[model samples]
Target: MSVRTIAVKYGVHRGTIPTFVLRSGGKLRSTGLNNERRASAAILYRDGHTLQEVADRLGIDPKTVRNAVVAEGISPRPRGRRPMAI
Candidate 1:
């Protein structure tokens, strides 16, 4: 069906719906504890939570969580950029 039909069936304004669905909001930062998150993520992995799950719970990417698992002695750092002092 066309946009008009979809809008009518869904009870929404077609133009408005398009705006809501395709917005890009830049980067999202996760602010959890580094040591705790790393340890917890490692434990979670050991306890059988998937890397993706650990990443979601700890607010980090799956790859980072996986790295923590792979690095063994290393830890997962909190997700954010270091602030400039200038």
Candidate 2:
């Protein structure tokens, strides 16, 4: 479980949970996109899906999706809306 979850369950501050974990030699997990999610984000972006679209489909933040696609060596599309072609 995440520290936040534990804190909420036991009524402790989220910050205090991390301190207790460190004192007990427990390691905290690093958050963010994993390899599979990154690959999925990249493929979706390459297939012309907007970052926000991919994020919504994957239930993650758009910035996280953006980072995932970039890490997969895909260049991000230009910002702002694209003009619909005639």
Candidate 3:
């Protein structure tokens, strides 16, 4: 699939798709340490911490926490408050 298609299907930025495709070519592999970190982030999120909280605790960016959560097949809560009814 094209990068745009993959991005839309996966709900990621189009810019990220190329990097993912390139990484899939075996030029780089995910390490156990990375998996552990992602797991840790997921756990923190599951335990009721917000993404920003998890990121702060992990010393990573909120976007990193969000991506890690999504990579683990978990849907993260929306970031902001609900809109008021008209």
lDDT of 1: 0.66
lDDT of each: 0.66, 0.87, 0.79
Instruction: Please write out the lDDT profile of model 1 over residues 9-62, one tens digit for every residue.
Output: 899998855555456643333333476666787888766577777888888888
- Summarize candidate 2's per-residue lDDT along 4-72 as a digit string, tens digits: 899999999999998998899999887778898889988988887888998999999999998998899
For residues 1-86, could you state the per-residue lDDT of candidate 3 as single tens digits?
56678789989999897687788883533422398899999888877788888899999888889899898888887776222445
Q: After superposition, how far is residue 73 of candidate 2 from its true place, in Å?
A: 0.4
For model 3, the local distance difference test gives: 0.79
Residue pairs of candidate 1 with colliding backbone atoms: none
Highest-TM-score candidate: 2
Top-lDDT candidate index = 2
| Of candidates 2 and 1, the better by lDDT | 2
Q: What's the TM-score of every candidate structure?
A: 0.43, 0.64, 0.55
What's the distance in Å from true for residue 10, model 2?
16
- Please list all clashing residue pairs in model 2, or write none if there are none: none
Q: Compute the lDDT of residue 24 as modeled in candidate 3.
A: 83
Better of 1 and 3 by lDDT: 3
